[model samples]
Target: MTDATTTTAEAETAARPWLDASLPVAERVELLLAEMTVEEKAGLLFQTMITMGEDGELAEADPVFGLPSNREFVLEKGMTHFNLLGVAPTAGAIARWHNKLQELAASTRLGIPVTISTDPRHSFTENPGAAMLAGPFSQWPDALGLAATRDAALVERFGDIARQEYTAVGIRVALHPQVDLATEPRWSRVLQTFGEDAELSGELGAAYIRGFQNGDAFGAESVSTMVKHFPGGGPQKDGEDPHFAYGREQVYPGGQFELHLKPFAAAFDAGVRQVMPYYGMPVDTEYEEVGFGFNKSVLTGLLRERFEFDGIVCTDWGLVNDAAIFGQPFPARAWGVEHLTPLERVEKILDAGADQFGGEACPELVLELVAQGRVDEQRLDVSVRRLLREKFALGLFENPFVDAEAADAIVGSAEFRAAGDAAQRASIAVLSNRDAVLPFTPGVKLYVEGIAPEVAAAYGEVVDSPADADLAVLRLQAPFEQRATMFENFFHAGSLEFSGDVVAHVAEVAAAVPTVVDVFLDRPAILGPVVEAASAVAGNWGASAAALLDVLSGAAPAGGRLPFDIPSSMAAVEASRPDVPFDTADPLFRFGHGLTL
Candidate 1:
């Protein structure tokens, strides 16, 4: 190259250094950071949920959740990061919407592309605050089901498939791989976690990260994994979640706080790019009693200094501001720091070393803090640099738009659905198969509850009642005490014991004929009575009716082992330490317990 040509190229680079793909990411980050206004930098600190407009357009507003219009969020507030809420009819719809969102972002002063994140959506659960149901995406068993398979390779494959689907629709971040241990049986969020064993959770969590980030090298193809609930979110007092004010305490009766952190260590080792501290406040531990989001001793001292994690640390939602959920008002989950004002909350979160505020959009407070000298502009630059570097590394600056048409083919493809169905079948754990009655002869008269009669007709004769049938199959959800509030009901916390009515119904069906009962083990249940009544018992996590029948009818092999212990009684669960794994005495079925076909 001639000197004149080199000089021309250098001039072009200097004109738009941040957009030059040839430049190093670090150099590009610095260039972008230097150009960003204080308001734009403030916008980078907040990442909240965004809803799509009708027919894939930008949402005008969501009065239900009290969210501002997408235009106001971007053009007015200058926020760039969003955790996409809800699903569309087709993958093309999502992809088209993403392009539109990116276009809106492209119109910004610096043209910094929006980093779209999502909660786990490729599963059956549809908790608005936590996860979304697999609408257009291929549906897989929940995380616990993956743990039951005990195959790290399969978990990695699932991650890779999910990554492909995510990127096809322009989603750049996964706010998941919730590596918290399910040591507490009544914990509301256990289904999303790999079961009680730390080693297993660690191994699978690492594989999950590898799959999402495309084997540790993050680029355009990668969906950055935000390994979450740092220092662990399990061991909730009485197994209640911290999402509610009443459930704020996180206790460790067994002094096993270190055990709960094992999975996060594995996630960190696997090159996870972001972290989210849980809403729960530590109780009786060496750390401060505030929520992890505001606990500087935990976030800065343990996670940053001890673990040496320099990646983005984001708080779990609604830490600094009170918000309405499902049209019901709830206080901000400030925990021990509730006395602080919203501005003070923001100052504390920044001081605690978190880079971004999850589930909030309050850039004005940041600006105010800066003006008041409570927060320095340099501190904002630190987080802004980290955030910008990620965008550059992800190749978002080069091209934030995705091929919308390709999304229809990639997401929920026939091959992907087939894989998900196979996983669903593989995850059904046969807990008890009395008198070797499982591989039921085809065309046997069957009575069923929960299993759709139309779907069950393929395997056998669909009978009206257990008395008129040769075999009966019933599906049951693991028992949970219903809470008072509507939002609280979504989280199935409280007791793990089934009601008397449920037990009596199961007994009645079993008395008429040999019965097979399958329970959805979202939370481990005291299943001794159910096991005794039924001839065969199976446990599932998000398997469809067809998938369950495929395994029971000998069409596919039963491959799942129990991911956690099934307690013999409620007394056993209450006696066990909240932080200790497999602590329940005389569990009905032990961890890794499964009967083969």
Candidate 2:
């Protein structure tokens, strides 16, 4: 036979023996492990987010696409796992595409199935911070809104819905339930978290995990939950995020670190199968300078040692290289011990004991490390073993295919959509309403902005703009820092400061009409202007525009209290110590402060 024919025959033979379900999970794992070489094992540990490129190749491969050329490289290097980026238009096409990829990976020795993961897809807004507008995915209300409903059953229901949607299109992992406490209002990533309270965040996060796992003790379609940013990500100094070089420290003064850990403990107790460390470092604290990805104290000492968590621990992305996205040069998360090469960073991360390198585009680097004796093959084996075991635990070997038709039915189902709407309604918190400038009686000429017309119609006549209405409703976002060209494109710096234009506009609207202003407080910003101008002002812990509207129209009561204190000004935030836990002596809105109707 020719070389091509011989290779094809070998591939076919290798796949034939594993179709039997009678084989034990351990036996299957060992068989697969034995078949994989060091190169293949290393590839399994490095997962990349896949999207289509301009040249009809994976976006991470095309030079023009600005992503690392890891797709072609993974195939060449014998990689086995990938996290599907964004959603496809049709569930059928996504399943077909995923099946084809699995076929290619199975063509090699072992026939190991490729496990695809995704961020939360069944929400109203696709988490813009994580993935860009690539294709269609089921959108749902932000987690904060979910928390507002205080319905654990609804949270579980949402999880089941997400699980069905994920399994239908071949995704087996859900990287979510970011159980981090929103203890710091200035933190930019708070919108993605459950909310500020420890007990609530933990309880809801656990319910979310149970919902996703769906009692399928071991199966492929049973979506595994990767509860993330362990030991919590909230409590950053001045509300700055750790994605950038400057804002990498995680401080704790209010003993909030322990509070943050509550949710994770709940998640672990609930049997969450996976964990992802935060990108921020515990600088000027008891822990070392590097991020949790490379912090043994946090990962090995706390999570593994104390909690006894046996789940897979994946790191946040881009920790091993200096790459630029959107015309900015961002360094790999070299937080504490500054002067290290990408290769050196990888070594430190391995030593710190992370199972996988997230957002990684290079398996070749892992191979090179193994070849140079910098990283041990046994260490690679350990992580690979855990990874493969999870695939087995997920029963991927038994059932790799999903019913695409069922997926379409599950996604955006009436039940799930209603849950989203309910969450949106529940999460809205009315912070101030001195004159009862709410529940605008019907037939009142209402001028509204920032709220959808359909949503505003429920209250009264919806106007085209703030100027035309009897009452103006303005939507606002908490201020975040702008990054320089030399920093990560999305990473924020400095304190939470609102735009002058936004403040001026709110004042303009409030002066003309009895206005109600809703601020999407992803990060807590100074609300002096908002509190002073608008007759009534509201804030949401998460992104729930619909929920804010519900509070305005008397459909839902504002029950959420501030998880973190809203700082008075950016200067006060900047002067605060990075090592201290949220001990801002004087804040605008103290923790546990909330107004009721």
Candidate 3:
């Protein structure tokens, strides 16, 4: 007979079934779920961005979000998942901070290990509250550049490198491989996607998923990938981003809805662990006109039932909660159900079959729903079990902390950086060679734009203007219609045409000297004018100036293909329907348009 008077010390020392690695993961999940309180279960449903003090310690309060202390959020509120934002100065510093954070998690009553997640940090794109700058990580070209390369092997390699870096720093979840089709040329977020082709995007998305998750499961040394914006977020109306009120509705005039689902389907087949729906509302589709998070027809009918995807479904950031960014108030993106209270929004998300609400920290509302009998505790068990299963599958129960020194050594290693540099050079796509003007002589007089003086000096004598030079090399960005607010400017959306001044400047340079023009194609640009004006034209997806120079000088072959078609004009772009892939009529440069010198 067991004595009820046994010491609390003895009970604490006894091994739990959930802690036994020998048991099946499913059994471990059930055992843990049986022991959890409602508060702990509710905590599994919310994931919010967590802030840290500059010294790698828990901040008393976050300056931007005004969030509660890490101690209060984790121990008191029972949050075991967090999205880490901002850059840490060194890999060793971030690793040590992760160790301390894990130690805190281990000290909790149930000793549940925390699982840290991150947005894409391997690229140049920077959103203060979303992505981190590449401090100690290897910087690769943007996702679009990888698409331009058309090398699945290279994409897999990037994924593998990213996995190693993420695992070392205790970031076990990757919130990307975005997988959305870049069918809409003017969409700002296309830089993060794998260009416009369904087959290519799907192929690369699968490779990316395999690289991050490391095969079929979230084992040790793996970072689980969360494939996002399901059923395609690319077919946005008039190319405006859905972040603001004016861009909430996604209109699919082309009736090519099936094309966008291909990448997500491939992601699932590749064993992706999580999915995130976008914030846009589907207008006039078969599904209800609601945000994906609140649309049961979209989340449940399409993603869950039709696709049979059993992975965790999480909503995109801030759908239910109104947030302030840099003192500007942004309303909740609840789309169709704007009239609903925060409580109702939470309920709808759950009912729509999402397991988690992103960019939110309101588990208390979940608890209230259960207390009010609006949600079944048994129903809550489903999401909690799935969440706990992932923690187990990741082998977090066995070990969660990382070796700080190893992290420093492994991250941004010379070999990794070299591979990324090679990829950058490989992604540069030469679009035109008029009169064979490229492959410049080492001592020619050169006029350049968007290239550093020191960098341009290596190829030739860099002149101040076109008239003083024998050749002009200009690098320009794909143009976008500038939005009003500072927050909106960060996203390059709207028009695809270069303004009159930019067009005239390039033309004037070409008139004075034999010009080689290269534009960074983050999105497909209206390049008919630039192509006509320049003696030779080139395009790159996230390639550096050094890489571009290598291609132009014939030091390296331009090995990339145009991932999307270049629009002939702004009029052609507007006449095309948003939903259809490759629907633009008479494209100036067709898909797979690349020229070798």
TM-scores of all predicted structures: 0.97, 0.87, 0.96
Model 3 weakest 10-residue run by lDDT: 4-13
lDDT of 1 by residue, 1-597 (tens): 999998987785677787889888998898888888899999999999999987778898898778899989999999989999888999898988889989999888777899999999898763555789788999999999999999999999999999999999999899999999999999989999999999999999999999999995789999999998998999998888999988999999899999988999999899999999999999999999999999999999999999999889989999999987777788999999999999999999999999999999999999999999999999998888889888988999888999998899999999999988888898889999999889888799999999999999999999998899999999999888878889898898899888889999999999999999999999998888898889999999889999998889889899999999998888888888999999999888899998889
The candidate scoring highest on lDDT is 1
Q: Which of 1 and 3 is ahead in lDDT? A: 1
Model 2: weakest 10-residue lDDT segment is 52-61
Name the runs in model 3 displaced over 4 angstroms. 1-15, 126-130
Q: Candidate 2 overall Cα lDDT vs. reference?
A: 0.72
Q: Write the per-residue lDDT of candidate 3 for residues 1-597, one digit (tens) a residue.
A: 346544543464355668877889899899888888999899888888887666677656776766888888788888988888778888887788788888999898788999899998887654433356778888888888898899999999999999999999899999998998988887888888998999999999999888888876569879989998987889888887788888888888878888889999999999999999998899988998998889999889998899998888888899888988767889998999999999999999999999998989899999999999999999889888888988998998888989988988999999988888888888888898888987777779989899998998988899897899989999998887767777888788888899889999999889999999998887899998999999988887666678889889988887888889888988888988887878889999898888887
Report residue 460 deviation for candidate 1 (angstroms).
Answer: 1.1
lDDT of 1 at 546: 93
> What lDDT does each candidate get?
0.91, 0.72, 0.86
Q: Which structure among the candidates has the greatest TM-score? A: 1
Which residue pairs in candidate 1 have backbone atoms (N, alpha carbon, C) closer than 3 angstroms, thus clashing? none
Q: For model 3, which pairs clash? A: none
For candidate 2, write residues 184-219 as lDDT tens digits. Answer: 655667667776677878888988998889854536
| Regions of model 1 farther than 4 Å from truth | 1-14
Ordering by TM-score:
1, 3, 2
